[model samples]
Target: VLAQNLVIQSSSEIRKPGDSVKMSCKTSGFTFTDEYIHWIQQVPGKEIKWIGRINPWDGGTVYSSSMKERFTMTTDNSITTAHLQIDRLRGEDSATYYCARDTMSNQGYLPYKNIPKQ
Candidate 1:
């Protein structure tokens, strides 16, 4: 079997509060729609934070309370890509970000597969 990996295209974004930003994640060596895509966050020197997860097949999303109001998750299966957009960003929103896949296997959700910061 081949190894699968998630690739995040954006790395480190600097935006002021109230501004909007979009980041993308792409998958390789696996069925893009077979699992869910999750977005994570980390401050300059803080622990990882769960932003939300998106079902690429149907565009369904579930967000954490911290991001529910200001964040949106989306995917385009045709392009094998997922996206996370932050709207009306807050001062505390400045941080490094990442994307991971919900393998749903014994290993569970795998994070930091692609440590894209934004």
Candidate 2:
């Protein structure tokens, strides 16, 4: 089988706490709808945070409690893309973001299998 990679893209911007930003993840070399796409956040010199995840096939999402109020997860199967939108950004929100595939064979499991970015 050919290897596949997940590509994430977002423009860096300077904004205040109330501002919002949108980031995207596009997949290549595999069936995009076959896996779940997850978003992650990392503040400078801090641990990684799990933002949320989306099912590309149906657009369903589940977010971390810490992120429920300001983070939204979405996906477009037609474009093989996933998106993360953050609203009311705070100073603490300044960080590097990433998109990764949830490679767990069983959806019932909670541990991340592997994260390719951030």
Candidate 3:
């Protein structure tokens, strides 16, 4: 279920192979720095995968094992936004992306909202 009183928004992107795409997720109605922001991806016909998450309070990030090198996560407290930048885009990178607050539960990082892709 979607979280109440929280609003997350992201835009769609288009890019060519070898290019880079930076997606942004903006949040409102909550304390941006107090929550962890996570990025996820869903391929056209596959399951959703966890990309990574950033600790807004300290700017620390933890990415999925395969995505460490080319993915970067950052946050801007001023605008209440989290950013996911993927370098060297490829055909396999074509998918919908999402950003959500990491509620930190036993289940793991779950994205309550989604972002679109390149």
Best by TM-score: 3
Scored by lDDT, model 1 comes in at: 0.72
- Model 2 sits at a Cα RMSD from the real structure of 6.2
Q: Which residue pairs in model 3 clash with each other?
A: 98-115
Stretches of candidate 3 exceeding 4 Å from the true structure: 104-118
What TM-score does each of the candidates earn? 0.80, 0.79, 0.82
Following a full C-alpha superposition, what root-mean-square deviation does model 1 have from the true structure? Answer: 3.9
Candidate order (lDDT): 3, 1, 2
Instruction: Give the total clashing residue pairs for model 1.
Output: 1
Task: Sort by TM-score, best first.
Answer: 3, 1, 2
The TM-score between candidate 2 and the true structure equals 0.79
* lDDT by residue for model 2 (1-118), tens: 1134646465565666677877766666568888887877776688878788888877888889989998998887888877778788777877777777777322322221221212
